[model samples]
Target: MFASEVLRSVDNMASKRSNTFKVLLASLAVAALGYVLRSPSLYLRRETKSSLGYPKDSLLNFTELTAEYGYLSEEHKVLTDDGYILTMFRIVKARNCHRAKRSPPVLLMHGLLQSSDSWIDSGPDAGLAYLISDACYDLWLGNVRGNYYSRGHVRLDPDKDPAYWKFYIEEIGIYDVPAMIDYVLNYTGFQKLNYIGFSQGTGTFLVMCSEKPGYCDKVKLVISLAPASRQMHTQSKIFRTVTQTFYRMEGLLSMTGLQEVFSKGGFSQEFVAFFCQLSGVTERLCEKVIDAFDHVDSTHLGSITNQTTRVLFGHFPAGTSVHNMARYGQSMNSGRFEKFDYGREQNLVLYGSEEPPQYNLSATTVPVMCIYGKNDGLVDTRDVEWLMAQLPNVLEMVKVEDPQWNHMDVTYSQYTGDTIFPKINEYLLKYTSA
Candidate 1:
């Protein structure tokens, strides 16, 4: 009787082991099938780099890419007041410039999760940095702290110290922007520089202008592209869902010590590059996914061809802290452009109230030109109008004539040359002294 009972027990254990092995095998089979389906060569005809007309090399950094296109480039390091160090890039010579004298300095700031490379990623023809340089402006591209290019601090290490990644957009507005502005002004000997900001770039600029209105005098004109403020009316379903998820998972992320997302040399960017480059089908699918977040359709991805999109993936989502994403989530939840919400208890300690304080947009006295697209998925037109109402000095508000133009279109689309850069040039030319 004892031997029979022991045999039964042994059979049960073997049965459980076999079931687990089958499940593991099934998972591997599914993953392999998916990879095969997404394979570039087996699924679609692959296009060579020469056919695409972009550079043959993959993942070239900013200065190398600029030099590859026959443009002279220089790099600068900016030390912020708060111990963070940032890398700034400049197009020292414009290919098409024939003017004897250099125009006043123009500084271009990038949006969230991006580096200064965004300005030149689309190449000389459509890139605003190249265009501004060709237009005879001393163009300077500034990278915010915590991105791929500017991930340095005086004391804390980003990889080891939790305190190193504690900053949000407000810190950027108050410290990063001002430091870069001062560095550019002193370097160029220009009293003021024309500013062009896209998405989060626009938000940080507003924060800088509002918090330190004196800096307003240091900016001759602000060309805000897709001003990303008051995002209560955001249209992207994917964006809404993601922000909500991030908001809910903030505590979990903090507990797990996962402070950064899409960071340089991180898994997020590597996965993106691998998944997007799998095949033409996957590339289109990738575009569709971006469209889901930006509410952009296939029609709007005009100049962002497959090759260009792949190259962009190599540089994009450079990096940002989870804290910054959570702040955006907080704004989405409250539907107000306010300071970081530290919950009721912590908010009381930091802000002297249960609720976080709102940025005083009324204090922004800079000459501003607000540019937005009608179909932008992330930033609703109503929010832009609401922002315009709050600001004290709005010079002009120009809506892009293209009906299908979306958020990323402002920076990456070929249509920007005809649809936006002309107006940007007019404003910069009007405000600057040759």
Candidate 2:
């Protein structure tokens, strides 16, 4: 009888241990969920006020001025092929003035992670938008889908939906640029418009020509600044690795509806702050990364503005998706503009069930002028030379002699008005009455 009682006690002990294990696991799960929920808020609070790069007020000022330059008196909107409503801001150089009839309109496309605000920063000086406007050329700035402005769609919400994020630079070329071109031409009542693109802005134009052949006909002239068509020479090892990893996980994340997790303001803003603190040492590291990623000379780290650096990290670097970065890595690895590999060389089946198309420069019949800084770390001079050779309708290829002018100098450098703007103005004036 005593032995029987001992066996019952043993069974009772086993049952209690099992219940305790279950409770521990449940508590762990709840803790993990709480961490996930609070992480974004913590990151946002830390990054929003961090002064690792430039002051927030200065960046905000720049954003405001850029918006002012693009504001149109009339309500301007366009619909993307995917049924997304894109908001466009316009500024007419001439109102009730005869000069508007003669001068061709210039459409300025900002690079990745940049909005229309990137074009202007309020100081004693003027931005490219104002300079072109002052030169009596009608300047219109464009904002891409993911930036601060132009975030809207019929079936997607960038803030709450993963479908909105299911795109990269390729989509911009295939849908965004073409739609903007069509809208601009239709609204202006012009047969063709002048095109100017910086960095990824120029890359998308190449994509448009590759994916859709008829697009170049709508453009009368094209000017590319720090243009990046091939990334084989790019130097950022971290960027390449991250992109490769992101591509591998894209499918899993999309399935889990966690694709929009990065879009959360808390997460994104915190990332910005973290990088800003790293900017002190990492800025130099960033220059090297950009140089290596673009196959430029890493030895030459030129002067970059604190504001420009902040914009790069807070606004540009973290803003792009892993899918986009993977495509860039593929482009760099192949030295060609092509679709991203979805693993096992299955891009053909995954991205459209066909081999990604190559950008065809011969189809771009527009008058194009390629401009580059001699010391640019992103778009190497050799790549630009090769790209120029591919184009059939080149108007002029101008290389700036300034050795200090790096990739961002075209937009942010103090000497832009004194050195670069004059050259651009001279070119536009040839086709404009002013």
Using lDDT as the measure, which candidate wins? 1
Tens digits of per-residue lDDT for model 1 on 355-376?
Answer: 9899988777778998898888
Alpha carbon lDDT of each predicted model: 0.75, 0.60
* Per-model TM values vs. the true structure: 0.86, 0.74
In model 1, which runs have C-alpha deviations exceeding 4 angstroms?
Answer: 1-58, 296-303
Clashes of each: 0, 10
TM-score of 2: 0.74
Write one digit per residue (lDDT tens) for candidate 2, span 1-434. Answer: 22222222223333345554344324323332331221344544334454444545334433343444452323367789987676666655322234443456788888755665556542225357666665667667777666545667887776677667677888988898999889888877887778889988898898888788788888777888878787666543433444444555667756665543233244434444344435354343344333433323445444445445555444442244445655665666666655665554575567655566566767666777878877665567777877778878888888987765666667656567776788777767665554
Worst 10 residues of 2 by lDDT: 1-10
